[model samples]
Target: AEECINSKIHEIKTLEQVIGKLITRYNVLEENKLKSLVNIYEKMKPKDAARTLNELEMPTLLAVVKHMKDSRTAPIMAEMDSIKAKALTVELVTRNRLPFATAGSGEGDG
Candidate 1:
């Protein structure tokens, strides 16, 4: 009975570990999907791109803004309607000013 209980506990622990790993993997996969989508949108014309970016969730918008190069971002921001551009500019500036937040960190923080 003792051996059986121990074996069952070991199985449960293994299952828990597997579940944790799977959840982490899924989150990574979801992030990648969002990144790819943003990349596709970025490649579009500025007007179309701005519209697409506006449609995205705030978190996703932040991610896309973080990934964008300054040159590309400037042009995209310039092309967007004033209200949208202003909002995005604020986000970009805020993201730049803060060192700890944003997507990938270190070195080129923004």
Candidate 2:
């Protein structure tokens, strides 16, 4: 009877260890899935997308702007009020380092 009880106790301990490992693996997978979903959602959100574009380094922003269709680009730029649009345009033109153009140059001059 004593030997039987020892075997049952050992089985219970082994079962508990298995359950703990499964729980650990489940938690890791859940965390990874949540992180991936959050990243995807951030990329897909229009506001976040605009902010990301606004924050990109000048060279990268220029490259992205060059490839974007004007139809798509105009609305995003227009979403900001006039002042912000002008500021961002100036920033893009100056590589984020200088003020907007002075009055001398006509719109078609360049």
Q: lDDT of all the models against the reference?
A: 0.77, 0.63
- Candidate 2 matches the true fold with a TM-score of 0.41
lDDT of 1 by residue, 1-110 (tens): 99999999999999999999999999999889877876786688877787777676766677887877676777777776787777777876776674555456556655
User: How close to the true structure is residue 10 of candidate 2, measured as C-alpha lDDT?
Assistant: 100
Specify the highest-lDDT model's number. Answer: 1
Name every residue pair that clashes in candidate 2: none
Output the worst ten-in-a-row residue range by lDDT, candidate 1. Answer: 98-107
- Give the per-residue lDDT digits (tens) of candidate 2, residues 1-110: 99999999999999999999999999999767655643453444445556666665655555555445555566666654556567668766666343444434756644
Could you tell me the TM-score of candidate 1? 0.64
By summed lDDT, which 10 consecutive residues of candidate 2 come out lowest?
37-46
RMSD in order of candidates: 6.2, 16.2
Best by TM-score: 1
